[model samples]
Target: MIVAVRRSLRRALLVAGRDLTVERRQPDGLVAALTFTVTLIFVESLAVGPVEARRPVIAAALFWIALLFAAILGATRSLERELEDDALDGILLLAGGRDALFAGKTLALAATLGIVALAGGSLALVLFDLTVALPFHLVLGVALGVIALPPVVVLDTLLALRLRARALLVPILALPVLVPQLVAATQGTAAALSGDAAASLGWSGMLLAFAIAYTGIGLTIVPAAIE
Candidate 1:
């Protein structure tokens, strides 16, 4: 049992490392995503204007909107990397099978999205000139949301690969799966910033549940789907 687990871990890390290395070598995709996210936040801040009375919810929504779109774009590019040069086929032939590839890709996707979320969130704060009562809680909410999103993003992208209008369908399929996450995140951030600790706790619990459920589904089915 130990041997099997160790082998799996090793192969998964190899897959993730390779992907990260490729990303390091060619960073245009990351740059594009960051640029798009920053531009979106800038435009939103201008529209909302600098006002002391601006609602925390508005800031939360704007932050998440940019995070959401940037995440989708990033996830698409992540999958495309595997498809290019038939790299995925070679990956699948590695010792741990499809599960290894899925595991590594999921980790890479989650990490990449997490970094983007942090950067975007920071830029949103600066753009909106916002202050919150519980900044740490807001971050936790975003972290959970990011954790939950990449699995669905990976699965749905795979499903959409065969579709004719994949670009539209990716968001269409993903948005509904993402609703619970977005709602929980938005509510949690608003509640935290408003100093409603009780409300924030409730939303955080929901966000954690959504993360666990989606992650389980992804790990269970993604490898099978790939085959």
Candidate 2:
């Protein structure tokens, strides 16, 4: 049992490492996600127009919204690399099962989205002049939200793998499922900014719950769906 578990862990890490390495070499997805997110935040900040009272709430909303779109775009691009190279089958075989592949993809995507979230959050803070009253909650909210999003995105990407309009369907399918996380992240950030620790914790807890649920579903469904 120990050996089997170790093997699985090794395979998962290998898969994740491969994906990250490819991303390091290519970086198209990362570049695109960051550019889009930064641009969205900048444009929205301009529209907010020097309104200090309004910046907190609007900044929270805009940060999460931009992150949401980044998640979709980045995940789609990451999955597309496998399809473009006809590598999905090979990866599944090497990984020994779909669960490990799912896990590795989730980890790689989580890392990618983490960078985008950090960039977006920093930009939001500077551009909106947003103050973080509860820094812990704000960071926790972003971390949990980033961790929670990738599994759903991976599953959605695989489900839409054979679709004719995959680019369109990916977001359409993922947005509804991701609304809870989005809401929690936004509300949590708002709470943190407003110095409501209780509320921030509540929303962060919700984000954690959704993260578990989404990742569990992804592991359970991905194997069957991929085959």
Candidate 3:
């Protein structure tokens, strides 16, 4: 069992590395995600008006909203590219199993969305003049949120691609599942900015739990889902 797990992890890393290399070479998904996220953050801040925008709670909420949607965009593009010329089928056949494929895709999506999160957070800080009273908590919240996003996105992306109206269905399917993580990350960021250490920790823990739960679900279901 241990050997099997190690082999899976190794294959997962190779898959992730391959995806990342493709992204680095083409960069369509990353560029689009970054642009969309930054634009959404700026527009959301404007919509909330200057006074409300400066509030840590408001800023955090807006940032999270933008980041989540950007995650969807990134995940979709990554998966869609694999659909070209039946590349995904070939990858799945060689990936050892669906679990490894899922893990690899999840990791790749996480890495991509991590960049979006960082960019959005930095923009929030600048636009709102946000001060982090507990930098540790803020960082932890962001890190956990990044870790939590990918499994859900990757699963939904795969499911959506199986359908005809995938473009419209991805957000519809993903949004409801993403709400808990969104709420946790937002509240955690707000808490960190407000110096509420306990609240930040609690929310961060929630994000971590969400990550683990969704990842497990993805691994369990992916084999059947992909077929």
Clashes in each model (backbone N, CA, C under 3 Å)? 0, 0, 0
- Which candidate achieves the best lDDT against the true structure? 3
In candidate 1, stretches whose alpha carbon ends up further than 4 angstroms from where it belongs are 1-7
TM-score of 2: 0.93
Question: CA RMSD for every model?
Answer: 2.2, 1.8, 1.0
Cα-based lDDT for every prediction: 0.76, 0.85, 0.90
Worst 10 residues of 3 by lDDT: 91-100
TM-score leaderboard ranking: 3, 2, 1
Q: What clash pairs does model 3 have? A: none
Best by TM-score: 3
Q: On residues 144-180, what C-alpha lDDT tens digit does candidate 2 reach at each position?
A: 8898888888889888987889999999999998888
Better of 1 and 3 by lDDT: 3
Report the C-alpha lDDT of model 1 over 1-227, residue by residue, as the tens digit: 99988887787787778777877898765777788888887888778776732578888877777777777787777777777787778876765567777667767777777878878888877677677788777777778777767777777876676566877889999988888778788888888887888888888888788767776786687667774
Ranking 1 against 3 by TM-score, winner: 3
Q: Could you estimate the TM-score for every candidate? A: 0.89, 0.93, 0.97
**Clash count (model 2, backbone only):** 0
Q: Is candidate 2 or candidate 3 better by TM-score?
A: 3
Clashing pairs in 1: none
